[model samples]
Target chain A: MTLWQILILASIACFALKLTGYVIPPALLTRPTPARVANLLTVALLAGLIAVQTLGQGQSLVLDARVPAILAAAGLYALKVPFIVVVAVAALVAAGIRLVT
Target chain B: MTLTPETNGAARASLAVGLATAAYGISFGALATAAGLDVWQTCFMSLVMFTGGSQFALVGVIASGGVAAGPSAIASAALLGSRNVIYALRMSPVVGSGWMKRIAAAHLTIDESVAVSTAQSTPAAQRVGFWLTGLLVFVGWNLTTLVGALIGNLIGDVSAYGLDAAAAAAFLGLLWPRLKHLQAQAVAVVAAVAAALLTPVVAPGLPVIIAAIVAVVFGLTDWLGTRTTSDTEGAPLA
Candidate 1:
């Protein structure tokens, strides 16, 4: 129930998932439907993950600097400006907003 | 020892991507602390989880505030991490025949390793590339995490740098490249909107899980829509 406990539990679960790939029948991993779901599920997970991290705050949602930061990252990424630049741009923009406000 | 072109490429990728991706770890360290993890916990997650996407998502859940964010965080992290299972399809047979080697490979099998191996021209090179990238990334990610965690402690105030946004943006950049198709874009949009809307009403971690269910719907329907009509002749659902 504590943070460390949650982390420990998550770690165990993650190890299981990775090991499943190694141990599961190859036939199942090769199947198209599961593969399709896994691929899209990754996209979905990213979306959900991004959405919460961008706006979430202590069990609630709020608009904040992450909005413009994320938008800047998305814009730079689309341009292929390079990965580090993308992260730096977002960080600078968000920090700029915080400094001013 | 002599080097081949493929071996050279693997080594180059190991250094380049390994270091680049490893540099990103500073952000994870800063953000993980901003999200309430101690330096030890942050490093521990990187060590045990060892997957970027899942580690970042777990931090997202923690930032949203729940010590018992167990189910949803694990579920989302596990779902994203399952891509390794798919990667395993390409990597499982190629890496090793022996159980010991396979076990080691399983621990190291990740995006960078998988990419480096597949780019190689031979089984020997693939094996070399896989271990090289995997070990480097593992070491680099953890090393940078320590550096960042130490700095984060010194900084003491996470909001000073707006690392929450930085972390979110960094993670978005990671996911952006994979959204190549219309269906993938649709799934991301639907999941985002669902999570955003649900966050206010649901428990901290549950919104993401709910968004995941929404994604499953989109994925299944998309698959069904593309199913060849001939193949579905006997399928009542079609």
Candidate 2:
């Protein structure tokens, strides 16, 4: 499929999933099992994304400036720096490392 | 004519969250274009997908594997978006009845809207919180997304500014706030390790999906024995 097709289809699918919650009987999916799994799965997917974005290159993992940039982000987050600032600092850290090395 | 203090508080909180979330649109905009999406495609995604996590997931996949990885990109995005289903379930009653209202509410049923609405004390305030936050975020996100895409188009090399690292940091920031529980921490560790290890062997987008499956298994089995009912209750805004 073309990018446009994927975009339209995925958006439709996402919207349908959202609508399903309202139309379906709440009891059918309100169980503890599905809810628990969904929560954990969300976190896990995000964790996986962090790893992939930072370390993965093509089909392989490579160490790069993203690693330290992520660390810098974590540190700024620990300090309760705002989200935009955290992102900017990470970019600066990565760019500085790239420039020096 | 005027809102009660409580209602005002909810509205204020909603706007704060909306603005905070909208700030990420610039990153999404820049990164989407960098991932090979044109400016309009990136803006369309912000307008249509309208979910921060899913939008980032799609662009992230494309960034790594290019457009040919469209299937995985969609899957990853849809998977991330599945959380909105949970939000919709929680929000159904809050939205009351009316087909038109439900349709519009479903579109607005995102993390910030749900969070702000549920935090309110009264039903009227809840409605205000939900709609205000949702609309504010939608407008702000799209506007900033256009800004980011335009900047991305003008910038010759995204990597020169370390936007790649910025993307990774953005995900890390989203994940960081959810690391309160030990079980969640365990899942993060295992999933990160598994994804890193599998990236080389598996197809580009498959590793994250596999990691999600791993999460489901761990979540269902209560592998770490730290799972509790409370842990599944709330999700922070993305």
Candidate closest to the true structure, highest DockQ: 2
TM-score per candidate: 0.90, 0.95
Q: Which whole-number lDDT from 0 to 100 does residue B40 have in model 2?
A: 82
Q: Model 1: what is its DockQ?
A: 0.61
For candidate 1, lDDT tens digit of each residue in A26-83? 8776755666676677778788888988888866777888798888888888887766
Query: How many collisions per candidate?
Result: 0, 0
Those runs of model 1 whose alpha carbons end farther than 4 Å from true positions after fitting are B1-3, B223-238
* Residue A56 local lDDT, model 2: 88
Candidate 2 deviant stretches above 4 angstroms:
B225-234
Q: DockQ for the candidate 2 complex?
A: 0.76
Q: Best candidate per TM-score, number?
A: 2
| Model 2: per-residue Cα lDDT over B156-235, one tens digit each | 47678888998888888778777787777888989999999999998898889899987788767877745455422444
User: Which tens-of-lDDT digit does each residue in B74-101 have in candidate 1?
Assistant: 7777776777777766677777577787
Q: Which CAPRI quality tier does the interface of model 1 achieve? A: medium
Q: After superposition, how far is residue A50 of candidate 2 from its true place, in Å?
A: 1.0
lDDT digits (tens) for residues A52-93 of candidate 2:
999988998999898999999999999989878888899899
Predictions in order: chain A TM-score: 0.84, 0.93
